[model samples]
Target: MPENGRTDTGPTAEPMIRLEQLTKRYPGQDRPAVDRLDLDVPPGEIVVLLGPSGCGKTTTMKLINRLIEPTSGTILLDGEDVTRADPDALRRRIGYAIQQTGLFPHRSVADNVATVPRMLGWDRKRVAGRVDELLTLVGLDPDTYRGRLPRQLSGGQQQRVGVARALGADPEVMLMDEPFGAIDPLTRETLQNEFLRIQSELGKTIVFVTHDIDEAVKMGDRIAIFNAGSGIEQYDTPERILTEPATPFVSEFVGSGAAIKRLTLSRVGDVPVPDWPSIGQDTHRDERAAAVRAGAREFLPLLDADRRPLGWVPADASGDVLDRGLPIVTRIGPGDSLFAALDAMLAANSSAVVVVDDAGAYRGVLDLETILSTVHTDAGPAVPRPGTVATPGTV
Candidate 1:
């Protein structure tokens, strides 16, 4: 594997991929396609290159694998200089997926995915096993689709095959150029989500090129906005880029609704959901009476034996227990975007949404006021239940 390790990155302590003073100019062109570009892609992170057409984003990507030779500069993968390495060999070490997919109509899906592994001289059993494994990884049913030709699959399926093929060799880095751009919006979103789930699991160092801001925001750990000279207009997280754009060009490119885009960065886990007044299902009558009289809550959350909330008991209702205030239907988990929580609230026409853990155990209630307070200031911590109000933690 070419002694891939960086002392700075533990045993592998340097940038997974580094481009320094990279420049590319066509023979007769007045300007370089990528002029003196410099970029460092750290291991286990997705760095998105986003810009307008003709802004050198794709050129910069191609330079890394030497798909197009740089006019002058250096390419380093895992800290070893690759400027002098064989282009084809360097490329094989880096997985590349493109918008067109480039699958072979003549080849079956499994064979297409096996391309890289086969080239690497794996035994037939290993190549076949890897092909099936990769096909399954990208959500294709190997048993059903393995032998099917690429033309027989739908566009989305073809794209999946492209991704699986790219991953067949399990390369440390992936270069994806608008790989989802051709799919319909709904399918595109589904594929994007699936990619995210896969990326989170695989943690491959990736350079994703896209012209769409929303897709960049959704996919990138850090986004680099490029200019004609390959200069970075802004390089930061989606939150900083949206909330505090570095330049007018960026603000314009990010488009309107900075506030709405901010919602994407804010997760339900990060909002401050205040503790509510609650009583156990077997609480004493006097205790229940005191809770209703105190009026600290609109409804006392009723807890079961396991500390999970049953339903709301209206504070104004008579007796220890009354008719269920409302069924606990929709819930927002920690990983969900605040935008989703707000949507759930609006859909239910409720002031607050229930937050729950993965097991469906109630955590707390997130209200509009708390969400606004945190988001408007842009300083909220994740799932802060302030004021030490003694929450049951499971409701």
Candidate 2:
């Protein structure tokens, strides 16, 4: 388990999964689909294998699930060698989700989800209760969708049911191969958000495969970019890959809109804010006027002794003494993504938002001017500053 209590002790001493010198060769193929791939997936992180089709991403995923045997090397699950384990036994302990969803056409939704539990010889009452519980957990009403067949639900709903089926036994690790690829854009985004929520609560170590760069960026804690024949080209945090592509192939794969993508991952704290003058409640009107004369702006952020924000103080006020609620105050946290700050600013009708720390203490403000200027600067790369960790619920 991790120190923060965000991970599980089930796989504490060893990686949730590890592929050491793994490779795969088709019957008559000249080269292996995957080449000596070595990777580690921590207990609560989602590691995405991203590359073009036939780049061995899918082949690598199947090898983990035992759907495809590795031509060479070993696969360890929670420190035990899976290569020698019974295929059914190994699969029962790992959740698997794929593009087609693979729900049984003849079985009711609830019964389909209950397949694993039934196959494992769970009690009748236990299977029924788990079916209902999982149905609700995946956003399907037990009374409404449980009795229906797989053909009865929408494509997106079917995908959700597929996820529910994979999670039936509460497997510690998940293997998702383009699970959202068959759905529409809006549905895909919805599923992605729901998956993120579920992963947070469940703390499953997930290995996700995708060819889309955007999906890779959005859904991965760390991305593994492969170059088909070259093995794993680069494996790093999404921020690092977007900011500093490990190779020319990686840079080209990420494309030209990388800057725009960075904005979504970068937080307000990553950009430097210009110093602005602020007035206190105790300042006299004449003195406030003097400070205003020194600076062009009339409004400033008022902070408490701990550098926590109180509110914005407007210059040329009527009195020297001020009370709480004298200034307008509404802000987002410093850890929020830049997109969130932008949204807050839009909704508040303000140019900036006072950035607060985890304790709600104000740190600084983020404005359009600051964000735009930073984007325009000759900054080498938009590396997430030290001290920033993945947001607890984010992939």
TM-score of 2: 0.74
Candidate 1 C-alpha lDDT tens digits along 170-233: 9999999999999999889778877877887788999999999988887887788876566777
lDDT of 2 by residue, 1-395 (tens): 11011222223446788888887877897877777778777777788888888788888899998899888989999888898789998898888999999999999999989988888899999999999998998899999999999999999999999999999988899999999999999889778867876776777889999999988887787788878673777887787778878788889999998877766676666677567656654655566556655776656666666666676655554453233314554666655566667777788888877777777666666788877776566563354421243342232
**Which regions of candidate 2 fall more than 4 Å away from where they truly are?**
1-13, 267-336, 340-365, 373-395
Clashes of each: 9, 0
What Cα-based lDDT does every candidate model obtain?
Answer: 0.78, 0.76
What lDDT, from 0 to 1, does candidate 2 have? 0.76
TM-score of every prediction relative to native: 0.84, 0.74
